[model samples]
Target: MFIELDFESDIPIYMQLVHAIIEGIATRELKPGDELPPVRTLAADLGVNMLTVNKAYQHLKQLGFIQIHRKKGAVINSDEMRQADDEFYERLLTSLRPLAMESICRRLTKNQFLTLCSKIFDEIELKGGKC
Candidate 1:
């Protein structure tokens, strides 16, 4: 769970934590039944507020990436994670809509945008990411 943060970025600290944890799970670095550091401890290590870590954990749980138990705290979900549903796909498209618009506004061709996406996808795939 070595989550690096870019305080300089506009992305919220909580989101950074969320993305890092998701990436770790995707890459198989954090396997099923793995216990994550408690929110307070992880926040201290990351120099972020405990609330930020708490928010990340909650989001992860909702996304089915992790499960939070009363005593067990946060643990990665089962190895057989659920497949994305229609709602998830719709949300994914909604999230990417703005980026697609931005690319077009910048005069990027569809091929260029797709190429960039493919490059990033390959980068993550090489790291054992399931995404």
Candidate 2:
């Protein structure tokens, strides 16, 4: 698992860690059942606090992205990924709202915005991973 953290970014370290791990899973760099480094080890490697890694792991578990075991440590969720339900669609819309607003404000046409989205989807799919 290769994770690059931008120390200077405005986003919180824990959230960045969560996103990185999620991206890794999406790209198939982290397959189901893969074990993540222990919290203390990952923290030391990333130069972040153990609490941050723990928090990120907890969040991922909550989102059904990974499972944490006392002895097994953190493993990618081996079960089939959860299907997107209404709650997920709601969350997705909430997350995309701000970006949509920004795109509108920036005068990005609907087609252009959709093209960008398609480009991203293509890139991810080309990496031979399902989203």
Candidate 3:
């Protein structure tokens, strides 16, 4: 798996790591049973603290994206991959509402918004993503 981090982003570094991993899974870049690099290795690779990687892994586990085994390391949880609960979807939509509203306020046409979504969906599908 490959991930690049921007320490300057307003979003937390750990959260960025978690999101990157999930996107990898969603994009089918990481498959079921794929063993992720050990936390220390990834932390070193990303030049971030070990704790950051650990926190990201913990969050991934909490979201059912990965499972950590004593000897096997972290493996993608394919069965539940991208299967966020209703509450999660609800919260996601709520979070997106502000951005959508901002786009509309900026005078983006309905077709433009639709086209953007279509492009995103196409890109995800092309990547062999399940969701």
Name the top TM-score candidate.
Answer: 2
lDDT of each: 0.90, 0.93, 0.88
**Top-lDDT structure, candidate number:** 2
RMSD of each: 1.2, 1.0, 2.0
| Candidate 3 off by > 4 Å | 80-84
The 10-residue segment with the lowest total lDDT in model 2: 122-131
Candidate 2: which pairs clash? none
Error of 2 at 84 (Å): 0.7
Candidate 2 local lDDT, 1-131, one digit each (tens): 77899999999999999999988898898999999999999999999999999999999999999999999999999999999989989999999899999999999999999999999888877877684
- lDDT (C-alpha) at residue 115 in model 2: 95
In model 1, which regions exceed 4 Å deviation? none
Q: How well does each candidate superpose onto the true structure, as a TM-score? A: 0.95, 0.95, 0.85
Per-residue lDDT of model 1, residues 1-131, tens digit only: 68899999999999998999988887778888999999999989999999999999999998888999999899999758888889899999998899999999999999999999999878778889883
Clashes of 3: 0
Residue 102 Cα positional deviation in candidate 2, in Å, after optimal superposition: 1.0
Candidate 3 or 1, higher lDDT: 1
